[model samples]
Target: MTLALRLGKTLAELAGHQAPMTARELIFWMAFDQLSPISDRRSDVHAAQIATAVYQSQGAKVAFDDVLIDWSGEEEGVAEDDDALETLFAALSQS
Candidate 1:
């Protein structure tokens, strides 16, 4: 069993024991756990680890190549989407 598979299972169990969560709600929990990006560089690192764990727990057969970068081009798109979502949520919460 890979790490992602393990995390997926954990996440499923957590969901089963609680209400369904939105991405924003999940991110908020991450913040509550002191895992948000602003507090520490490790936060981002931890976030990726958490994501991988969730994938594994879910029984996905993901590999490094499956999750890792193919090229720098992929990063740009991902960063843009992440930034947009983060900004939107940040703004909404502030007001």
Candidate 2:
């Protein structure tokens, strides 16, 4: 698929997921994904992080796919190192 189209689709999927995204996860899927931004543009990483924090705090006030997800991600945020991220991505592939 074309890069922009693929990125758009990925963004849509990100919007549909129930979990609260950590900054690193958001940055990964937005900026470093195989489908990346055009050279003239960049993902709105800061704004996305702020928005995620808002959605997480609003909890019951927001719903995704008609389902209310109370995904409290206390210690479940994406890992900080490459090996852990590799493990996380491997686990995600099985989901």
Candidate 3:
């Protein structure tokens, strides 16, 4: 996968997190956050390798692409209007 793919995947994961993320997650996320507008530089490659290594240390024999790209086939949650509920009290707030 490309660096853009990596950054996007990492960002999506971070977005869904509601609780505190572990140091490993933070490290991994930050590593891929680089924009690298000039294409993959030497430092970026090193960062990618480090990110992959972090996963490998946890016993996952995954590649750089695997760690970076989202493997979940599930699509991002789309907001659907609940007309039935909206019709009701604007309904009970989940919060």
Model 1 bad stretches (over 4 Å): 1-39, 63-95
Q: Residue 26 error for model 3, in Å?
A: 39
Please identify which of the two predictions, 1 or 2, would achieve the higher lDDT against the true structure: 1
- Tens-digit per-residue lDDT, 53-72, candidate 3: 99889998888865453435
Where does candidate 3 have its weakest 10-residue lDDT segment?
A: 32-41
For lDDT, candidate 2 versus 3, the one ahead is 3
lDDT of 2 by residue, 1-95 (tens): 24524565544345676555567656765556446554332334444555666786888454332232224544455556898889999999999
**Over the stretch 8-42, how does candidate 1's per-residue lDDT look in tens digits?**
54343455655455687566657645633333454
Instruction: List candidate 3 stretches off by more than 4 Å.
Output: 1-40, 67-95
Error of 1 at 20 (Å): 50
Candidate 2: where are CA atoms >4 Å away? 1-54, 57-80
At residue 34, candidate 2 shows an lDDT of 49
lDDT of each: 0.56, 0.54, 0.59
All candidates in order of TM-score, best leading: 3, 1, 2
What TM-score, over all chains together, does every model reach? Answer: 0.26, 0.24, 0.27
Q: Which numbered prediction scores highest in TM-score against the true structure?
A: 3
